[model samples]
Target chain A: MPFFEAVRLALAQIRVQKLKSFFTLLGVMIGVMFLIAVVSIVQGMGNYVEDAFAGKFLGVNTFNVRRFPDFNMGDVTEAEWRAWQRRPLVTVEDAMAIRDALPAGTRWAIEDARWLAAQSPYVASGPQALVQAVTPEYFAIKNLVVTQGRAFNEQEDRLGAPVVVIGTEVAEHFFPALDPIGKELRIGGLPFRVIGVLEKQGTVFGVPLDRQVLGPFHSALHRFTGARRGLYGVVVQAPSAEAMPEVQATVRELMRRRHKLRPAQDDDFVLESSESALTTWASIKRYLVLAGIFLPAIGLVVGAMVIMNIMLVAVAERTREIGIRKSLGARRRDIMAQFLVEASTLSTFGAAIGIGLGIGLSKLVAAVSPLPASVATWSIGVAVLLGAGVGIVAGIYPAGRASRLDPVVALRAD
Target chain B: MTADAHELAGLSTTGERQAVIGATGAAPGKDWVIVTRGIRRDYDMGGEVVHALRGVDLAVRRNEYVAIMGPSGSGKSTLMNIIGCLDTPTAGEYWLNGVLVSAMKDDELARVRNREIGFVFQTFNLLPRATALHNVELPLVYAGVPAAERKRRAIEALERVQLADRMDHRPNELSGGQRQRVAIARALINNPAILLADEPTGNLDSQTSEEIMRVFEGLANSGQTVIMVTHEPDIAAHARRVVVLRDGRISSDERRDAFVSKLAATI
Candidate 1:
């Protein structure tokens, strides 16, 4: 018989036994659904992280020099940790020295930022806000745009002027009814004029990007309790992305010389670029993908088993039909192929439903939550292939058993 | 006995009278549709051997309408199975259309069955799920007929059986006689060298059985060799020649008139 005829026969059988087919394929459907949905969400998160690292948190041409690597805390070796601990802390002095040593046209900023316990400016309630003490160049280095009044000038930062730039959220909270740029807001029981309000930068990795205040480094050092310890980090921007490697090399050399480190000794600070961040994220995404595929693969195995069991039953039930086919001159291979096609048809059907449901589920999640998700085309392909593969593998035993049946005995079966 | 019965009986005993039987490798010619010499079949019933057929010799010629008749456990069904290529004989040579089929393997037998023989069953055995046209198309499908040609041939076969108007109806929708005609159409669609029927009208009423017998008569008259296996004396009487089996051996071979007269005498 033609292969398509066998497939059409399988489809007719499936149609005749709709409820049984649905129940048999349910496990595969749910398995594929889970796989596609999780993969889509994970891929979406990866895309969002890439965008945030390149545009919002760390601009494409910018790099950060810190006392320790920011994102790879768990990956640090014991010896590396000890070596970094022996190094001097990155301070405002080192930030200044590195800035001066860099090539012309390069921009740099030093800032210390941390979440601090505080009371709301408008209410008696306590709220936590990110407070940053930064130099005048911080705004340019971080690519933050002032939407309201002008940013504090070099004179204000040099003279330790008592002025602040607030984020959109802060501006909305403290001066909802008035212009926030000229208003006064108290931080840590000290009053400072809001010299500027930043344009809104949305969330990144679920963290609100526009929910903080910035103040001149000198004023913050004098007024904030923990600001006197040291600079948290230094941000540097090359002329363009092409010059970033040279800028990094110059900064490293300048910092090492300032700290009096010999040629053989490791530098105390870590220079993190967007590339390193993305590489780390990629590694994490790899694990996420494995975990996503692994759990759902268990479901697929169970689904395959279900299909195999049901197919065995079907073969047994159609023993006489098989006998009739054999008597009509159907070879064992033809019978086997028929049953195998039937099994794959069931699995592929389940997979198609799974794809639809998975996309719907991901869309639902995106709508209800801040988590972003988009279906990956490759994931859909994998889902379909996996479903069909499971079907073929599961059908082998049952199809073989059916094909090996003795026609005389099968024809006699009631 | 009548002159025809005497002649058939003489023909059945020719090899034995001439001492030419049991020639293992002797091949029959194309004039002979089926020839079995000392064919035997045994079943292993959990170590106890049950002999189904003990050296039964049978010969059928081209275009001959022959009926094999026996009671239950007389080995006639087993003989029918061997003739249809559904089972191989245990220890003898069986040839169909000049081919030594008893020595053939399972898949080879299937191909031979597809190209050389057609089978009609007691229950009509139409696939309950398929329409009459699809049922008739089945044999051609196994023969690897192209789809268009297969449909055309199947339609022609159904039309020959006078089932063209009912081609779209399923087995359940057709009457018992109509179902048997569809089965006959399926059996003939492959244009096999012989038509093998196993109690073809066993499930139908007498009127329907007669209706099916008339169809068989037409087929045999059209030069198609027809082999029908039945226990009914009247059913066997419809064939041109009748071979009666008793205790796994041929007890008598006679023409239709002689067999019917003997049946009437016994009643």
Candidate 2:
């Protein structure tokens, strides 16, 4: 038969038996919808996570020198710490030396850490804002914004000035409905001036950045913290991604040289890059995408079963017609083509409906909630093709049966 | 253009007149339109072997009309099935239009049936929802005749069956006789070598049966070889030859000459 004629005949059958075709296509629709929806949500979440990390950290080729690893299985051995401890850890002199060593190439060399005498039950504003304490270079590193005032300066830190900068949330929490930039508060029973309020940066890993406070390194160091010799963490910045490894190596060597470590001793602090943050984010993204692919594939298998059953029914119903066509000089290939077309058309139509619904749902979620979502072109195309391919593969058995049917017996059937 | 039956006699009027007289089945292979020898068909009905045809031998010449008559269990339908090549005999050779149908595969047999044998079932077997024109056009459609030619040939066939005016009427909209005429039109559409009808008039009234028989008589007189199966002797009487089956075998064969002497006086 001609190609157009075969398609016309298949369409006629589907039109005549609309209910059967609808139900058959429904299976494929649900399957493809599951795939599109899962992929969209997971992709949105991955992008959101990236944005959150970028907002909270001053991470332009920045690396953190911290004490421990988040995913560490066990504590560092005493011997390991003792070996590391002998290497002089970061100090003010060491920070100044790194800055001097880099010359014109390096951007910022900042060091900071908080020493909490007690948790303070996480103090709040009258309307319940959140708070934390950070230092001067924290502004340049994470690209912090001062919604109102300015960050502390070298003059303030040199005199151990008691000026502090509060996060947007901290200002809202402790000094609601009032200007908080020039306010005063007592932490560890020492008075401090609130110089600048940080811009509103949302949560990262459920920890709100804007819900924190900031202060000069020396102000917190010599007075409230009362730390004669304790170090928190160090954050360093490089010119660009191309110079990150060189900068990290140079800084490590500079810290080691300044501390005057022995030949056999190791460095004391953990040096981590922004890649670690991205690595964690990437694993989560990969897992989400994997989940997205797997669920749809499972749904496709179920839809395939439904298509198989429906095609079997179609072959049974049209046995005499098949025989009639066969008797009129149609080949086995023609029989196969007719049935496969019928099945695949059913699935392709279903997939179109599913993709439409998935896109609409994504849009609805974006509109009604805080979730970020965008559907891609390839997702729609792939979903439709996958549905059609499944239908064709699933229809093979029934098409084969129809093609192999004994024409004599089929014509004899009432 | 307005030639009488005398001019259009003998299969084709001009092309092959000297050809068919040369040699035929009993002599060679040219005379016979169908040839069967020691044909046997056995059916396996749930492990029990049942013989539907037993060592049957027959030949049908071009331009001959034969009706097979027997009771229900006598296997006349089975015989017609074999003659139409919708089936194959288990134990003998059968040829239609000089092709050994029994040796051919299923798809090949169907092609032969499409090209040579036109089958008319007792129920008429019109696709219920299709119009008479489309139903008539089906065989030619399957034959891959282009659309315009198919429409023309189908219209000619419908005109031949006197259903030209009812071309667009579906089977359900037509009477029983009209429906049978459409089926006959479909069968004859391809202008095959033989028209096989299994009780063509079985579902019709006596008056309708006579009317259908007149159409069959006209078809045979036009040099289209026609074979029919009927239990009614009155139906069989219309044929120039009658083959009687009994207990899965041909019990008797009666010629038109013998039957003419027996029944012309009553007519």
Q: Best candidate per DockQ, number? A: 1
DockQ of each: 0.75, 0.43
How good is the docking of model 1, by CAPRI class?
medium
Model 2 agreement with the true structure over A1-414: per-residue lDDT tens digits:
566666676667778888887777776777788778777776666666566554356366777665433323234588865666655445556666766676355665455544332222234323322323334666787777887888887778767788877767667666767787667765666667888887777666566666565677667634433233544456677778888888888877877676677878776655766577666667767777888888778777878888899889889988887876765556677788888887787777778888988888777776765557778778988998997798799889999999988777887776
DockQ of 1: 0.75
Task: Write down the RMSD of candidate 2 (Cα, Å).
Answer: 5.7
Interface Cα root-mean-square deviation for all models: 0.9, 2.2
Candidate 1 chain A lowest-lDDT run of ten: A117-126
Docking class of 2: acceptable
